[model samples]
Target: MGKNIDDYIDKGLKGTPETKPSERREYLSQLRERIILALTNGQVIQQKPYKPISDLMKRYPSSKLYLDGDLDYMHLSKYIRIANENNIPFTIVDDKASSTNIGLVLANPTAIDKDDIFVSREEFQRHL
Candidate 1:
C-alpha cells in the first residue's frame, strides 16, 4: 500500500533550522554574482512593482528615488509627477542604492537606450 498523505505532510511539517548569518551572507554574495553575470550578458531582470509611490515614501521617508539615466522620458516625467504629488524627493543618478533605506531604484530595460552606458548589477553591488 502507498503511504498516506498525512504521513508525507507530517514529514514535511518538520521545519529545518534557520540559516546562520554568515551562511546567508555567502549565499547572497553568490546570488549577486550570478545576477551580475546575467545582466552583463544582456539579460533583463523584471522586478514586479509592488507599492505605490505614496506607500513607499511613507515607509522610507528618508529615501531618495534614483532614476536610471536611460529611463524613458515619458516614464521619468510620470515618476516625477507622482513624486511631486506625494511630496517625495528624487534624483537622476548613475548608481543605484545598495541599501533599500537610502534610495529606491527605478530602471526599465525597455526604456534604456542602446548607446547608453548602463551600470551593471556588479557595479551596483560594489557600491553597496
Candidate 2:
C-alpha cells in the first residue's frame, strides 16, 4: 500500500506554506483572550450598548451598573438603587435620555477624584 495507518497518524499536521502568511487568526485569538482576561480581572471597564437596555447582570456580576436615561423612571428610580447596592457609579445625562441627539462618553478616573460619569454636549462632542 502506498499509504498506511502510519501515514494518517499525523492528522493534525497543516500543509507547509511556500511563502510567509499573515498571522491573522493567531492575532485575533490573542486579542480575544486578552479581552476575556481583562473582563475577568475587572480591568476592562464596561458600558451598556448604544441603544436598548444593555444587560448588566452578565458583565457586572453585581447590581453595580448604571442605566442611561433621566426620563425613564425605569432607569432613574430602579436602576440607580441597584447601582448603589452594587457599588457601581451611575449617572444620568443628555445622552441616556436622547441617544441620537447626543452620545455617551466613558472615562477612567485619575488623581483627586473617583472615576467620573461624564455626560454633556461638550464631552460627547469631544469624544467624537
Candidate 3:
C-alpha cells in the first residue's frame, strides 16, 4: 500500500509513464507499429511529393498525419495539402528537444504492426 501510494504520487508529479519514449519522440509521438508510412526530413523536402504517400492517405482515411515542426513550413506544406485533400486529420509535432531525422509519419490510432513503414527514394523511383 505504501509503494502504491508512492507510485501514485510519482505519476501525479511527473505525469503518466510512456512506453518507449525515445521511439515515440523519434516517430513523432506515434509508435513504430502504428505507423503506416514514414519519411525523412530530406525526403519530405524533395521536389515532388511521393506518390505512395498520397495513395496511402487515400487508402487509410482513418489514419492521421504527423509532420515535424522543426522543418520549414514550405517543406511540410505539400503534405498538409495532401492530408487536407484526403480529409485526414494532421498534427505538427514541434518538439525542439527531439533529435530525429524523420519528418513525417502517417499512423493509425491503433497499432497495425507493419514491418515496412519507410519508403526509400530508390523504391519510390522504381515504383514511379
- Tell me, what's the RMSD of every candidate? 14.9, 17.9, 1.3
Shift of residue 50 alpha carbon in model 3, Å = 0.8
Residue-by-residue lDDT tens digits, candidate 2, 29-79: 112212211111011112322221133333433222323342445324543
Question: What C-alpha lDDT values do all the predictions have?
Answer: 0.39, 0.30, 0.90
Query: Please, what are the lDDT tens digits per residue for candidate 3 over residues 26-128?
Result: 9999999899999898888886788778889888889999999999999899889989999999999999887899999999989899999988779866654
Highest TM-score scorer: 3
Clashes of 2: 0
Error of 2 at 84 (Å): 0.9
Off by over 4 Å in 1: 1-51, 94-128
The segments of candidate 3 whose C-alpha lies over 4 angstroms from its true place after superposition are 126-128
* Over 4 Å off, model 2: 1-64, 96-98, 101-128
What would the per-residue lDDT of candidate 1 be over residues 20-120, giving only the tens digit for each residue?
Answer: 53422332212221121112212111232222445655654554445443444444565566567666676754433221111224322122223433345
* Span of ten consecutive residues with least summed lDDT in model 2: 36-45
Query: How many Å off is the CA of 84 in candidate 3?
Result: 0.4
Weakest lDDT window of 10 consecutive positions for candidate 3:
119-128
Return whichever of 2 and 3 wins on lDDT: 3
Which residue pairs in candidate 1 have backbone atoms (N, alpha carbon, C) closer than 3 angstroms, thus clashing?
A: none
